[model samples]
Target: MRLSMRARWALMFGGLFLLAGTALLLINYVLVNEIVPQAGLFVSNFAGGPGVSGGATVTAPPPVLDKQFFQKGVEGAVDTFRASAMQKLLIASGIALVVTGVLAALLGWWTAGRALRPLNTITSTAQRLGAESLDRRINLDGPQDELKELADTFDGMLDRLAAAFDGQRRFVANASHELRTPLAVQRTLIEVAMADPTATPELLRLGQHLLHTNERSERLIEGLLVLARSDQGLVSRVPVRLDEIVDAVLRSSAAMATEQGVTLASDLEPRVVMGDSVLLERLVTNLVHNAINYNEDGGSVLIRVGDRPALLVSNTGPEVPASAVPALFEPFRRLNRERTASRDGAGLGLSIVRSVTHAHHGIVYANPNHGGGLWIAVDLPLLERTMTSLSPRPGADPAISRG
Candidate 1:
């Protein structure tokens, strides 16, 4: 049978007391048998003369060792020694067993409690940590022991959970908003066309409007899918030139700029980075498109790329509130001033930019431009090889240029 820790400790200490008590009793028995008889013989030898009479000397020499008296004296001495030794041993054993047993029990309980305290905290915290109560954390204010490490790990898990839940909430809200826009437009167009059946031109216009709305819906869904894939870390990535991506975005944004009467310019320097080229291109394109779409008439858009690789796209537009800047990269957050603009987007542009930048281990922020517009800055680490290729060589395009 197996014994519990406490029981084992008690038995160990009790056995040690028993062994010590037995040894002491045995020592007492031997000492009493040898010493008592020798002392009796010495006393008798000193009391009796060297030539005492036979009867007196022989019969009363020493009562302890006399053959006639030997049995009785030895028996009495042994009995007395046994009684005393047994009594002392019993008392000592009882005291030692009680003291040691209590001490061992207390020690075992204390040690076990100390070892399992963190586990208890973990269990309690886990029980409380569900979908509604993810913010609860374990108390780690103890020594830097294994339990503290365990608490730290638990805190990390809670952090991850909180981030994941926040992401999920944002995603759902954004998807709903994006989906609602096209559905609302389609419904309005259908109602108008039905109300004016006499005008074929209106009907045709409404059909075109519905088609465009459907296309927009499709695009939003596709964007959501891409964002979901990116969140899942499923996108294939490879090394692509950062400058190439900027050039591509600038070319794409030029047509939009011409339509808006806004000039789009870029100063892109050659630099390489590791990422999915297609996504990076799309990310840059979205930023440029957003900047140009929201710019004022006759406004200018600037794009810059170089070491400490950055893309600053600023345009002349109405100022955004300083407090609202932090939420600009959050999905579905639209500026108050732009709420009335017909070109207000689905509000996922900056979110996509942030997500893509995060995937590449980069940061993007928005700040007020000096000329009364917003500046979106994307800063990413430059790859080692990109630094080596920075020097201008003969017959090569200048290291930096604006086009």
Candidate 2:
């Protein structure tokens, strides 16, 4: 099993303590029973009266060597001492182990924290960092250890990422501007040709087709530019009334809905959010347009604004496949059958909505309606009430009404 660093350190310290204590206990056992007794006998023999040697007259009689008595006496005393010493050794070893184990645990915890401090910093930095905050760095200051090396590598990677994103934003912005000039020239030339007094019927038909094609190209470029700008993140925020944006979108799309034979319905409540007004308007417009374009004839679109979520757009249309719903937010992705039926869209409507919502730190959800159609809702952060002016309260009308 894999163990965390803290656990590993605790085990290591505990094991070392156990091993060292065992070794000391065994050494004490040997010294008390064997070495001390032998040393005492040698000392006693030297302290006794002198013994007769080499036929010389002995000044004092040598002590009798009573083998059995001496053996019994020494053996009895040694046994008593051995038992007492063994008991003391056991008690001391037990006390030492208990004390050392607790000390080892505390020491291990402190050491582990010291060793993993760098990793904690790295984790916090990564969590706080994103595409918008890539400039923040973990300039770790310490010895040139392994952790320091890892921190350095992470900072270098962030540097590369920030540079790459900057390059992409510049390219998109420049390319969009560059392409607009030629497109404008082409449009002017086509208009001049069509306005000519000598224009033929066949030439007029061709000019109309070219004009439509150029307009589609212009919309595609505009969508790309919006996507790029949204990816750069919002730099400023202001309180924008979501209901006002919804009413504006409804006004603009009323003609399109009428021409397409689709009924429009809405129940918008006054809800204020913090975001860019232009982007929020675009977000609402794209969603309303998509609901109308993909809808069936005589179908209905329902828009709702609430204090909680801010905005929701749902439409009645051909049955949408559950699996294909997620791909609706991807750029240039469209259902082949749906695109073939509706020639006006460039498949960037929902994608732009998603990007703009994300830039404002909001969330968008899409769900396929049971029988047919799609339901999309946007949840945006609300502006604080302190900054909002008070208005007369209206009764809660969560019900959708069609006009």
Candidate 3:
């Protein structure tokens, strides 16, 4: 049968008291029965000796007197001794049993609480955890002890679970929104083409529209797959120069900027970091694409890389509201003001950039630019080898020195 913690403790302490108290009472009974009677007989014999009684008692008193008196005296003495011993044993045993039982009960209760504290914490934390508070954790102290180790392990599991759930939610939301956009466009074009049967040009336009929608859907699917793989830790990583990556992104984005009538400029410096080159390239590409797509015609975009292994992409555009910046990194969340006629995206660009940056142990943040644009910053730690080689040494290689 399953017993509660308190019940188990009570049973344990009660059993111990029973065993101990029974043993003590038995020892007291043995001593009273044998030793008390023998000692009483010896005392009676000594007191009934010759010349010990008064003249009224006559010579040595009668033998009957001695026998009867000794017998009576011994009987009374033994009775009194037994009574006293029994009284003392009862009092002492009662106190001892009470004290022992109370102490044991208290100690048991305390120990039980200490033992189950981790489980209690786990229960409480689990109860409080939900979609909005997945990052909450149990306050386990250290890993050296057993319960603490278990709590830490549980917290780690929660961390992974929360990440998995969040990723899944983002994937579903982004996929639905991306799919919805192209399908809506295709439906609208089809209706227009059907209604205007005499317009051959309109039919051709609708055909082109379907092709574009298909292409967009395909790209969205590809991006979704890339994000899923990154979340699954499938991306390969290696040391790559951040400067070179920035240069490549700049070159690629420059053509797009020209087509959009936006100017692209870069102020990149030499910096190395360790990460997946393809994912990092995608990260930068998404940021630049977002900047260009959201910018006004003749807008300017600036890219910067620094020794701290930071990348900043700022474009001249309408400023996003402060309240909306936090949601910008979330999938399928677009700022109402930035939803212009020229902008076209599945709204997964920033989400992808944020996820990839997180996988690389980096942070990306978006804020309003000083003038009238949005600024996105990617900050990562420099490569270990690069940092080590940068440390100053006497007569070091001039080529390796910081420019």
Candidate 4:
């Protein structure tokens, strides 16, 4: 089993105590063994030993001198006493050592838990955080130690991130508002030019082409703005009927699908998601539009809305590689040379879908179709957490930015 840092630290503490205790016990045993023998413990004395000759009485070197000896029974008794004493010492000390070691282990566990509590706070905060919640801070309070420093550093990083997001939101807002006015003026001029009765056929055709290009730019800009808005965050939470939105997208996409010889089909259940209504509509529209536009002639586009995933859009067209699936959602990142040649798309369809999903705190992914094309799945929650109210954009829908 994989051990957590706290567990490993606790075990180390317990092991160290056991090691020291065993060493101390060994030293005590050795000391008692050596000192008891020298202390004359259980010594006994006797008067005589066998004479050197067969019948000679026991004698000393001189008349006044005497000799002492230990009987075999006396030596045996001393050995037995020492052995019993050593055994008792070991038993008593062993029990104490075990008890203390257990206590040491419990103390170590508690100490480790306290020391690592800050890390748990950091982990939980990181897990709960997202782009939308970058404003959150750890603000961990304690002594000015390593953990506190880490928390302060983390808070600083969040501060910088929140500022950056705010700046990007501001830039997108200003650019969208400023740029839309001129484009609107150009569109007016183009329309007025095309309405002239005196205009020649070639002039009319040129005007029409210019008008088409201008509209394409407008859409590209609009898609970009929407992308920024979604990236900034989800605006609000209202009960949005997802199936109804898909139906509306399908109706609007009917002409494009017909022009491309593609069939638009749907199997939508009554699924209501908690998200911005405009964002939800844009997400569905982008998917349906991309599906129809990217498919082959006489191919089919299917939109399925259900409880689990919320939305699924699949089409039959070009064969996309497995390795290229990740790039599909990236802004302006398209597969194949033909993708750049598409006239209607600003190449922000899937990108917009991604941003919208992120704003709603949902999951979006895609896989290459078995035969051809791609299948995209958007998984959104039917309910959402508390959301903040966002200020409305002056003259357009929720706009997006490039960052």
Using TM-score, give the best candidate's number.
4
Candidate 3 has a TM-score of 0.50
Candidate 3 lDDT by residue in tens digits, 1-403:
8998766876787678767877887787676555544444444544566432211221333565566666667567657866887788778877887778787777877887777777788889998765445778997875578888888888999889888877876776687678768767876766676567586876777666666666666566667756764554423467776667767787777788899899787776666777788888888889888889888899888777775548988888786777779898887677773442223666678888888887777888888876567989999876655444542323311221111
Deviating ranges (above 4 Å) for candidate 4 = 37-80, 235-239, 338-342, 381-403
- Return whichever of 3 and 4 wins on lDDT: 4
Model 1, stretches more than 4 Å misplaced? 1-199, 234-236, 337-342, 390-403
Which candidate would rank higher by TM-score, 1 or 4? 4
Clash total of candidate 4: 9
Per-residue lDDT over 1-403 for candidate 2, one digit per residue giving the tens place of the 0 to 100 score? 9997877887787778778877887887776555444423432442344533222322322358564565566557756775777788778877987788778877887888899889989999999876578788999999999999999999999999999988987797799879999999999999999999999999999999999888888888888888888888776778887787888888889999999999888887778888789999999999999999889999999999876577889998888888999998998788654552327567788999999999888899999887689999998887667423645224432566533
Cα deviation of 21 in candidate 2 (Å)? 6.0
Model 2: residues with Cα > 4 Å off, grouped in runs: 1-99, 235-240, 269-274, 307-310, 338-342, 380-398, 401-403
**Candidate 4 local lDDT, residue 152:** 93
Q: List the residue pairs that clash in candidate 3.
A: none
Per-residue lDDT over 1-403 for candidate 1, one digit per residue giving the tens place of the 0 to 100 score: 9975555655665566667666765686566445443434433543453533221233334555565465456446646765676677667866766676567656666766666767888888998665445779997788898889989998998999889977876786687678777777776767677667586876777676666666566556656655664454413457777777777667666788999999876666667777788778868887888888778899888777767546677777777767878888877666763532335555677778887787677888888766567888888777666456564322322333323
Q: In model 1, what is the error at residue 392, expressed in angstroms?
A: 7.7
Instruction: Work out the TM-score per prediction.
Output: 0.50, 0.73, 0.50, 0.80
Instruction: Give the Cα lDDT of each candidate.
Output: 0.68, 0.81, 0.72, 0.80
Please write out the lDDT profile of model 4 over residues 129-199, one tens digit for every residue.
77667877898989999999999999999899889988887899899999899999998998898899998
RMSD over all Cα atoms, model 3: 13.3
